[model samples]
Target: TLSQHPDKNLHKIAHTRSSTGPLAERVRPNQLCDVIGQESFLPESPLGRLLVEDNLPSLILWGPPGSGKTTIARIICRVTKRYVVKISATKAGVKEVRIIIEEAEKRCALCQPGTVLFLD
Candidate 1:
């Protein structure tokens, strides 16, 4: 079915999120300084430190809609030379997630860098 269950519908309120598609591409920061509008968060702060360390733990990016959660994920990957594979719960199912996960595992195996699995 091309529909979602009530409690799990991400698209029900995709306000500022780009509707182009889910995880269409990794949006790398244009420059180290191009990441704008995050006073509380810094480029090379604790999060930056983690990215540099290449041992970022899994996290649940919680916030109201349009809080730049998606933007931050890309910035994390950019700063770490890492790769983030975002997937929307509404547009994707377990099977698709599993497939991307397998690919991510391969990317991980090489110790390429950190990968942020952003979900909404």
Candidate 2:
């Protein structure tokens, strides 16, 4: 059934919003260029310059609740085009972390590219 749909129609359907999504989800930046504030840590900054050169690193972003830690992580994953495996520290346990690590390892072993494990 999915294969029967036209590609153009599928694109339109994918972009259509349900209107029930959270305000944050609705306004979230889809690209790094759209993200405002945090000028000192963006791609033009010293830290960002280093990250741009080496996108694969275990990074820890600590900030207040609304300070865009998640946003920055999403942008990093997007810019690098790396697979993202998100896990909330409040909800996930060691077993979940181990599974994610195993999956990431498997992806690496297959030469399928690396992943960004975003611990929210």
Candidate 3:
């Protein structure tokens, strides 16, 4: 009877829906609590504590592939209420950078929190 059930394919359908996105995109953490590792570089660290409190200075995150740099950047921007404009250095040129800066300036002038230019 189970083999002849009309919903026999339900599990396959659920699996397909759950695994729709790319592996990396699907697994990317949406918040700090979901992030793993890099504990020493977080607010707990001496140097990082100041940055976390102020959340003002521009940061340059350098690390190997899959090192959670993007995740950390996202978390910082989210916590600071900053807008994020992601750009790729390899594809973006001076013109794009200038445009982003001008837009950021306008947002800042409006008393918006700030912007984080995540250069990937």
Candidate 4:
């Protein structure tokens, strides 16, 4: 399990490596279909079920930092097999956001492959 890895000692291997938790250690999801969370909106919401089941759509997780928003988004991207693009409103400007959206929109038929935009 990732929880059991010697993440604390990763500093010895790489000075830039973080040791907060496994959640931030990895990037992108291994499988979107395997994502977990948002049970309350399941079976009812179209987009919610897609996120929890089909692993499709752009996800805008609105909340403060360290709230599992990025973790959940990462999981969804993994299971869905769609391209995952991460961005931060804090660091990005409207032009940058537009560029990312335009690029992500180009995925699949709309514009590559399917995309799961995860904005933090």
> Model 3, range 2-99, lDDT digits (tens) per residue?
34546655444444454877545644666554566876555677645755675657778888988888888776766766788888999999999999
Worst 10 residues of 3 by lDDT: 9-18
Clash count, one per candidate = 0, 0, 0, 8
For each candidate in the order shown, give its overall lDDT on alpha carbons.
0.61, 0.73, 0.72, 0.58
Candidate 2 residue-wise lDDT, 21-44, digit = tens: 764665566555456787755677
Q: Where does candidate 3 stray beyond 4 Å? A: 1-18, 41-43, 46-54
Clashing residue pairs in candidate 3, if any?
A: none
Q: How accurate is candidate 4 locally (lDDT)?
A: 0.58
lDDT of 1 by residue, 21-61 (tens): 45323232344344556544554777556656766778666
**lDDT (Cα, 0-100) at 61 in candidate 1:** 64
Residue pairs with backbone atoms closer than 3 Å in model 1 (clashes): none
TM-score of each: 0.53, 0.67, 0.65, 0.51
- Residue pairs with clashing backbones, model 2: none
* Cα RMSD (angstroms) for every candidate in the order listed: 11.4, 9.2, 7.9, 7.1
lDDT of 1 at 47: 58
TM-score ranking from best candidate downward: 2, 3, 1, 4
Can you tell me which runs of candidate 4 are displaced by over 4 Å?
Answer: 1-38, 41-49, 52-55, 64-66, 109-111
In lDDT terms, which candidate is top?
2
